[model samples]
Structures are given as C-alpha cells and as structure tokens.
Target chain A: MRGVVTLHADGLSKDFGERSALRDVSFEVSEGERVAVIGPNGAGKTTLLSLLAGLQRATAGTVSRPPEEIGWVPQQAALYRRLSIRENLRLFARLERVADPDAAVDRALELTGLADRAKDELSTLSGGNQQRVNIAIGLLADPPVLLLDEPSSSLDPRQRAVLWDFIDGLAAGGTAVIFATHEIDEAQRHADRILVLGDGELIFTGTAAELHAAGGDDDLVVAFVRVLEAQGH
Target chain B: MRWLLLKDLQILRRSPLLIGLLVVYPVVISLLIGFALSRGPDKPKIAFVNEVPELQQTINVGGDQIDIASYSDRLFERVDPVPAATREEALQMVEDGEVLGALIIPEDAGRKLQTAVALGGSAEKPTVEVLYDASGPLQGQLVESLVDSTLAEANVAIGERITEVSAGYLNILLDGGSFSLLGQDFDILGLAEAERILGRQAAQLPAGSTERAELERIRRFAELAVENLDFSDEILSSISNPIDVKETPVGSSGGTTLESFAVSASVVFSLMFVCVLLAAGMLALEREEHAYGRLVRGLVSRGKLLAEKVLLAALCALPVGLVMLVVVALLADLDWGRAPLWTVGVLATGLAFGALGVAIGAVAREVRAASLLAFGLSLPIAFLALVPAGTVADPLYEVIRVVSAAFPFKPSLLAMDAALNETGDMWPSVLHLLGLTAAYGVLARVALRRFG
Candidate 1:
C-alpha cells in the first residue's frame, strides 16, 4: 500500500444505451502489483480494463491516474501490416513526441527481445513477434503503469509462456501490471491478487490462497464458480 | 510527424503505379491542350466565279484571293475556288464537283446597261445565274450575295456620274438654300448626289479668285470624307480581333508558359493528394480491426491521433504535388515567375484534400467502403475544378461553385489561372484555399471526436 498508486478506480461504471457493461466497479493497483481480472464472457472484465486504461469514460465514477502514464497491450496485438516493425515503432514514438526516439526504440526492442527483427515488415513477422512489437510500441515511452488486455489471446502455449514471462519481468521491474484474461489458471499462476468479476460486479478480490481456502478442495476455477453461485451469476 | 511522413513516402515509393496515374494524367492533358490546340486562326473559306469586270474588281478589293490552281488544293486545303471557260461552263462547273457556285454575267451586260439608261427605266436584270451542288443551299446563297454586291456598286457609280453633270449645269439658277433633288429615278443620279452637290456649290461661287478657296475647301472635305469612310471598316475589324494573353509574376521573373505548366502540375498533385488519402485507409483499418481500443489504451488522445493522421497526409501530399509541379513546368514550358504561387496553392490544396480523405476514411467502417466513398466524392469534385470557371453554366454551375468553394482543388485551379494569365487577384484564391483547408480541419476534428 505504501508503493505509488498507479491506478485508482472508484465506483467505475459504463453503460451502452440501457445495458450496463461495468457496474460500480472499484479497484486499485500500486507500483509492482500484478492484478489479474478474471470473468466469464460479457462479465465486464474487458470493460473494466478499458475504463482503467482511459479508453472509455466511466459513466458514473472517477478513474484517476497521471497523464500519459499508461502503456497498453491489446488482445489482438493490432500491428500495422503496411509498416515494418522498426517503422511502426518509429511512427508511435514520433506521434507520442518521445524524446530521444532512437534510444527509446532500441530499449523497447531490447525489452521485447525483438531487436534483431526490427527490419522485417510487420506482415512478415510471426504472430508472436508482432505481438511483441505491439508490446514494444506500448513500452517505448517507458510509462509507470502497464495494462494487458488478454495479451496472449491468440498465441500458442509456447508463445503464451514467452509473453507471460515478459509480463512477469515488467511487474518485477516495479511497473504496475494489470492484465485481464478469461484464463483462470494462467491468472492464478502469475497474479499477485486476483479479482473475480461476475454479472458486472466484483465477487472476489483476494489472494489465490484466500480464494481456495474460502471454497475448500476446489480449483481456483471451482472457487470462482462457487463465488458466482453465491452471487447468482 | 517526421517518421509518419517518411513512412508515407516509403509507401508511395512502393506503389509507383498509383502515384504515376495520379500525377501524370493531368500533366499530359494540359500539355496536349496548351501546345497542340492553342494555335492556328479561325479561317472559313468561300468559293466564287469572277464574271463581270466590276465583280472581279470587288473580289480583288476584298482580302480573300481566289484559289483556282488545283481543285484538290482549293477544296481540301481550306481556300476553295473553282474556274470555268465561259458563263455556261462556270454554271456547269458549279453543278459538277468543281465549285461552290457560279456567277453568270449576261453576254451584252454593257449593252443592257445602255438600254436601261436610254429608256430611263430599269432594264431586264443582267442575271447572275448561280448553280450549286446539292450538298448545301447556304453556300449557294452566299455566292449570290457576292454577285449582287458587285452589280449594285457598278449601278451606283454610273448614276452618280450623271447626277454630277446635271447638278453643275443647274447650280447657276438655284438660290442659296438647302435644295433636295426631286424625282431622280436613275441609279447613276442617286449615286452622284454628293459629287453633284459639290459641283453646284462651286458653280454658285462668284467668278473671282475666291473660287480657289472654295476648291481648297472642297478638296479638304473630300479627303475628310474618305478618312471617315474607314470607320465602319475599323469597327468590323475590331469585332473579330484576337488578343494575346500574357502572364507575369510580381515576385519573380519568368515566362507565361511557366504559369500554364504550373496549372498542369497543380492538377496532377491534386489528384495524387486525393488518391493517397483515399488509399491510406489508416482509420478504417483501425476501426475494422477494433484497434481503436488498443490506441485508446496507449493513452493516445483522439485529438492527437487525428493530428498525426493529418500530418501524415500533408507529408504524403506535399512532395508529390511539388514533383508534379516541377515535371509539368519543365515539359509544358510554363513561366517560372508564377511557380511559387502555383506551388503554394497546389500544396495547400493537396493537404486539404488529404485531410478530407482521412476524415471520410475514418467514417467508413472498412477499407473498401472508405476507398469507395473517398473516390466517389473526389471524382466529381475534381472534374468540377478541372472545368474552367468561365465556361460553367446554369444550376449545375451554381452548385459546382458552392461545392468547389469548399473543395481544395477549386481554389488551387483559380490560383493557377490567376498566376498563369495574370487575370485575377491571387489573394481571393489564397483566402478560398485557406477557407477550404480550415473547413476540412473542422470536419476532421468532428470526425475524430465521433469516430476516431
């Protein structure tokens, strides 16, 4: 709690027409904290990530953070096919008006382990490399907070492991890491705290041990199921 | 901004065909029109047969010389004339393929004139029997008028000589008052009225040396009248006169040809600007892939993203516009003085159109839709701008004027026209271009807020 508060969302809610995508959600993650938000499809996990990322305005609450302080890795990587890896990074750096772009780009590529493949076009790169470039683009400015929205959604198990290791390294380096995923097991392995969301509301927010102890002899998935059952998901 | 511009340049380098079409087509058309069609005089040919001596004299008086040497040369090479051995021969020639028409003068033309004089009434008309090929009736009519004018001048001259002699003999008995010639039915009498009046005035003068002063006055009057006779001729000549339009620049020294070249170049660049903006497909691709979500999470404000795209589009459009401007100027032999004005106008137009393309692309949901929408909107606008403002007409013209006022290319065209021809003020065109650019800027901002 003494660490710098990277993100502080209080009573965060979003609505599309009459349907509530996120309802009165509150969460906080400090520097060096790794929080995994897990939920079934349409349970507002992505919506909460969007809200925290400042991608969308919360209809009913305040989500505050430092300006230009968030780095995001989207679920699909979203690399430009027309651009080379280096060119894409260069464009992002230029658009963001990053100071000393050459060094920033080098650091991003080095961090993502894509320094050697920078010359290749994005279309020619493998899905995993492209995802790494996407993450590299996000990391170019060296922001204090990092948000990954199912960053490993389309990767193979090997690719996912590589991505997970990259995320772990960032969290270990004092960057506040917040990832949203449908993969409960992966979240259990990497998350310092797991927040379970059901029906547009948070059902559990504690360590995996506490979650398991509260619902005995059950996997984190079963425990989440019990929590959902109690909450009538 | 630099990196984004460089990226667009690289893309343009990769796609050479699109760039070539965008920049070359307008230049080619301009060169073709400026050099090839902008020459030569509007010459229309008329064919005639010379029969009466007076008719032949009138033909010589007019500037059009008879082209009678070779039938092929006369008819096919613009100056048409046909020849014949006799009056009947000429009529037959006209009926055949040899001539436009024939003018048949009566064999006893002088004798018929004498008979008319002796009888003191009009004699049988010395007919100018005109014959023509079945191709056109108008050509035959024109030939008739030519013969009629020749005969009319002859009759007037004969009448004028007779009246002069009579007036000289009668002036001694006349009182000094304005006298009107009464019942003078002879064509020669009417023609000689001016000379008869002069003769009568001379006779009425006293028989002394003062007659010399009267003679001097009469001589001066005749000279003045002759000079005044050319007034109708001057008016006629001025009516169909040609003017040489020349262009010069206030800021630079160059030739008029450079201004034309700049217009060509500007058109090429305008097209390229529209094409690249349409082809970039950045926003549509992002929306299609749902990557807007990613961009938002990266702390990229929508305003920043819009600015980035506009910067990229300007980067793409400016150089291509310059390249086209230079190439066209060189090829079209355009005046160099107007080059700066043309360059600025073309580049600004390109930027505005580029922004519009991006804004339209952002509204579209897919790349195909974006391309279709951008192209569909720009094609008509480009065509409207391409048409000369002077030639525009009707409701369509008004509509085009309003639409083109907002379209980037329109102001560029007007600016090029002014620069090339030195015909209008450059400031209005500059203001129009800026207004269009600002309008596009606002539209792009709205699009970014709603869709980016």
Candidate 2:
C-alpha cells in the first residue's frame, strides 16, 4: 500500500442539543491506514465516524478531503433492500460518477465474492453476504477514504473474519479505512491505530502494543480500561 | 440517474402488493366512484298537500276557460310525491322521515286567483309553504334544494297563467280579428269564434238607450285597437322567450347524466394516486431502513435523490390517471377530449402527488405514518371531488372549491371538466394544476433535502 496522506481532521468536536458527544478529537488517515474508533455505548464512537464520513458536520473543527470522494457504509447496510445487489452497486457507482459503472460494479462484486449473488434482492441475501454487498457498494467508487459503522455487528465469527479479510484487501490497495465498532478485540487485531474515546474525549491514540505500554497492561481490554480510567471516565 | 430510477421501477415490479394495488385499484375504485355517482341519490321525497281543489278549474279566455292544474302537474314530476290525507298529516310524515319535505297549498288559493283575475288579474299570487325535517343535515339540505327548484318551476307556471290572462283580455277586446282564443278550439276559424257574436251585441241593444251609446263607444275603440295591432318581429318575440338565454353552457351539458358523473369520478380516481398511500410512507420507509444517510453520502445529491423519487412516483401515478380517464369515459359517455390538455393535467397531477409522497416520506418516517397521511390527504381531495359536477357551481360548494384549487386533483379535475364541457378554455385550469404540481415538487425537494 502507498504511504500517501488522504484525510486530515483537526480539533473535531460535536454536540447534540445541550449534550456534547465529542471534544478535541483529531486524527489523520494516510493511504492504506486502517483506523478504528472504539468506545463503549454513548462514548461518541458512532458520532466520530459520522463526522468523518461527512454524514454530520463537526461542531468545532475542519475536515480536509477531496469532495464526493468518500465512501460510507452504515451499520444497517444503507443500500435499498428492495433493489438487487448488482442494482445497488450500479446506483452507488453512478452517484460517484465512476467512469465505467458496469466495470466498477463488476470489480466490487469480485472483490466481495458477491458476483454469484449480484442479481439477488439484498433482503434475500444472508447477513454475511449482505454485509459484503454493503462493503462492495462502498468500494464501487474506489474512494481514497472509506468510513464504516459496525460492519460485523450482526456477523458470526466466520462471517466477521471473511468481511475483515475483504476490508483488509481494500486497505492493501491504498484505501484509507476508518470504522466504528464496539468490539475492542477486533480493533486491536485489525486497526493500524486505535482511538479510545471516553465521555466525548479521545484519551488514547496508538497501536495495540503502544497502548499496552502506555497503560502498563498486556491485554488490549485492560489497556482500554486503563485508558478510560486515566481519562476519569 | 438511470440506475437510481430503474431501481424504483424494479421495486414496483417485484413487490406483489404494490403492483396489485397500482394495477387493480384504478379500475375498481374508478368503477366504484362512477357507479356511486352515476346513479347518485334516489328521487327527492316531497309531499304535496293541495288543499285548493277549486284551482283545478279552467281559466276563461273570451268565454273559453283553461285549467291551471295542468301546469302544476309538471312540478311534481321531479319528486317522489308522497301521499297524505291533509297538510298536518304531510308535516307529520316529514318529521317521521317518511318524506324529505312537504308543499302545503292554501285552500283559498284558487278562490283568490279567480277573484283577482275577475278584478283584472291584479291580486297577489297565492304562495305555497314548505315544511321539512332537518335530521340528517346533508339529506335535509338536499331535500331543501329539490324543493327550491320545484318552487322555481311553480313560479314559471304562475307567470304563464298571468300571461294567459292578459292575452285573454286582449282577445276579448280584439274580438278575434287577429287575436287567437287561448282556450277554445275552432276547426276552420283559428279562434274567430269571438268575432261571430259581434252582430248579436248590436241587435240586443235597445233603441236610443244609454247602454246602446256605451256599446257603440266600446265597439269603435275595439275597432281602432285591432286596426293598429303590431305584428312586427319584435312584438312576436313574446310567443317564445322574451329573454332567451341562448344557453352556451360550459360543455355540451357535460353529456348525459352518466357523463357528468365521470368528470368528478375520474378526478377522484386521479387524486387517489400517491397522496393516498405512497407519499405518506416513502420518507418514513427510508429513515426506518436507514438508507437515507447512505444515499446522501454516496452518489446522488440530496436534491437529486428527492427529485428522482418524485419522478418515479409520478411515473407510477400516470397509468392510474389514464385508467381513471378511460373508465369514466366508458361508463358515463363523458367527453375526455382535448387530449393535449388532459395529458398535461395528468402529468402534473402525477408529479404533484409524487412531490406529496416525497414530503410524506420525509415526515412520516414510518410505514404506518405513510398510510395515515395518505388516508388523511386522500379523503379530503377525494371528498371534494366525489360530488357531482352540477353541484360544484352551487354556492354551498364554494368553500370546497376555493380550498380544492390549491390541491393538484381539483385543478386537473376541473381542467377535465372544461374539456368535457367543451367550454373551450381549459388552459387556466391546466396552468393551475401545473403550478401546484411545481409547488409541491419544490416543497418536497426542500423537505427531503433538509430532512432525509
């Protein structure tokens, strides 16, 4: 994977009504980098991903990236379920203004191993296949940055491994992947850098080894607890 | 854009429930509306308590009398005239709901008219009182309307009687020179029976009496009046209508009874499109599935997404509109002409509903919400349109009409009315529908873009 800078977020913050969801959150994702936003429920993991995905604008900071170049995969698979997998891919490709929509969809189907089920209604697919189709639609644009929210939340262990492998392949091809997930172990294994947020504040940002070193804990779970404890969460 | 649009079509084709509704409802509901309005209500109930039996006597013209009962008989033809023993009995029947209303004629009505005519037709015309039961307000209003119309006809009848009396007086004075006796029939003389008695009056007068002198004076005056009688075209117009309306109504009476109903029925059918079901649920479905966020971040702009959805819905609505047009025309002998005008109206109507659907999609945020809104929006437009076209011009309907103009269905319905009526000027209505459709489109776009 190429080591080219793709996305830069500085001092990102978000608030909903009187409650703050994120504060002083900043991160840079280079080409081929996989960043995981990990936090307990209501700790602003989804909020941060939403902000980076451009689904929601930050309350107090700037995100610098090429316009219309980010591919976002929502937790529930945001494509139309009534539409066939191929149709969904084709629609997303068209939206991205891909030079050749047919080719883009075909490549996405191949990458996700969804070529056989491309013509099937998304609702008819198993959860694993549907999730793969979701990732495939996100890949249709060949975007430099991809944001996913809980892509494996509904997947079994084997399905989750299969999805992670496909996502890893995309990152290998110079794609910057940022995802939000509740699974701290998965983040430790797959993420190049883990962002641990507690009570709307980013308390730790580093690889699993570095996080363990900083927290004086060997296990990634203990390291996560230590990080949150240090932040007084 | 193509892919996005095709997906909607694909969904429509694949969803059995949706396909069934779109294909079947247009025909079934159109027929239902057509049937419901085609026969409309039964004959309005009326009780006639005609106490003036003496009014049945004939009116005398130059000693020839004509009966007044003949003219009044036509008034009762439009109602289901109920039978009752007396005026009080008729009133009770109305209260009991046996009849909608009653017309109570006074016993002295004939005597008054006769005595008034005897004194040169100068007395005021006797009036008939109307009594009605007010229960079932709508039905009550209907009965009242029927009674009012009947009364108008009766007034015309009275006017004819007065005209006859004056013409009879002229007959007496002219002594049948050119004046025709209104009541007496003569085979060879054309009402010249009055002139045959002229010499008898001369012989009956006493020699050198004052009565003879007065008879001579009247005869001389009558002679001069008959000699100077005007038969020009202007004066002859009284034989026909003195103020002939010349009709020129908005379309050929909107065809026979069935045809007129079609205009309103088709309108109602067209209105049932997306605003009835899909518009209410569209955005709600999107939010429920959480697809809105993905689509916004992906290919299409928010504006484009909304526009595309509206376009799809409008496309779906077109066939339904066409079905309404065809079904109504078939049943009612309705004139569905000015193809260009109808085409534009149908398209705009479809788009407007589509826009409404987009708005619904945004606000409902749930399937049930969509259904409720569709039901909510549909009934009002449909109700306003459900009435017969003839009643639309009634002052009672003015409120509905004004409110209906801002809606897509009403304008399209009215445009079709102009076309069916052959009133020749339908563009104003067409423009109204298009303008409304555009407004709905703009509103839906704004809403979905902001909220979706």
Give me the candidate number with maximum DockQ.
2
TM-score of chain A of 2: 0.96
Stretches of candidate 1 above 4 Å error?
A1-5, A90-100, A213-217, B1-301, B385-396
The estimated TM-scores of all candidates read: 0.60, 0.65
Give the number of the best model, judged by lDDT: 2
Q: Candidate 2 lDDT, tens digit per residue, A111-144?
A: 8887888899989988888888888877777889
Compose the digit string of candidate 2's lDDT tens values, residues B93-161. 766556666777667666665555555444554556676654222334555567666666655565565
lDDT of 1 by residue, B288-394 (tens): 76666666554476656665666666666566666766776678655678778766665555556666766676566577667766765566566655442212223
What 10-residue stretch in candidate 2 chain B is worst by lDDT? B241-250
Identify the candidate with maximal TM-score.
2
User: Candidate 1 — what's its lDDT?
Assistant: 0.62
